[model samples]
Target: MATKSLASCIFCKIIKGEIPSFKLIETETSYSFLDIGPVAKGHALVIPKYHAAKLHDLPDEYFADTLSVAKKIAIAQGLENYNILQNNGRIAHQEVDHVHFHVIPKPAASDEEGLVVGWPAKKPEMSELKALHEELLEKLG
Candidate 1:
């Protein structure tokens, strides 16, 4: 498991108030703030107080507060349409090493605003999917 890197982690610095941020909500286990560079006007980020590079690395206890804060931010912003995004690594578009959830509001139906996603979905044989599902179930158990 990854340990907290308080001294070197930027998110940790923000949480400790060593770096200034446009603060939104602060909970016992999470901190939320406005995104410095927003794809949309109400884009915000919620992060767990415990430092973790990925969601799977985070302590289970930290999850509720992180998700709850994101929900609160979305509701407070009155976002009718939005995307709650969490990226696991650099290849997945995670710029910061700390685990975070982005609450990006879709204020308008424009390519210029909000997160624009491309879904290059692929269809696989049902037998292949069944085998994958069985493998995952066994691992989960």
Candidate 2:
């Protein structure tokens, strides 16, 4: 793979041992760490050792490995419920550029600091919905 932008990227520094994170697991393809700013207790972020700013940019191997790490953490963390969130781009509210999956452990009663999932309005105009569906289909196929 080609060299990636890692100069000042936080995750890169974490991978390079330049920073410290609450590391849960590490493997050849991916690294898993507890989120310092977690959505909930045991909330973790899993990412590839290689840099990628968005989900589509991520290598399949790395994505798979990251998910594997997340699953293990979920079970080990004793999560009653969980959500896997991977956002991209500014519009998606992805604060970090690195492609990371948030493994959030949500229970019946969540702490005030934890993530509370929200579903935005799905009431788009028919034309807008159709156009978006077509575009996504093209990309998928």
Residue 59 shift from truth in candidate 1, angstroms: 0.3
Candidate 2 lDDT (Cα, whole model)? 0.83
Instruction: For candidate 2, list the clashing residue pairs, or say none.
Output: 39-115
Query: TM-score, each model?
Result: 0.95, 0.82
| Predictions in order: lDDT | 0.91, 0.83
Query: Which candidate should be chosen as best, given TM-score against the real structure?
Result: 1
- Error of model 2, residue 138, in angstroms: 4.6
User: Which regions of candidate 1 fall more than 4 Å away from where they truly are?
Assistant: 1-3
Tens digit per residue, CA lDDT, model 2, 1-141: 443657889998897778998888998878889899876778899978888899888767676778888899999988877888889998988988898889988866645645675768677899998999999999999
Candidate of highest lDDT? 1
Cα lDDT tens digits, model 1, 68-116, are: 8999998998889999999998989999999999999998898899999
How many residue pairs collide in each prediction? 0, 1
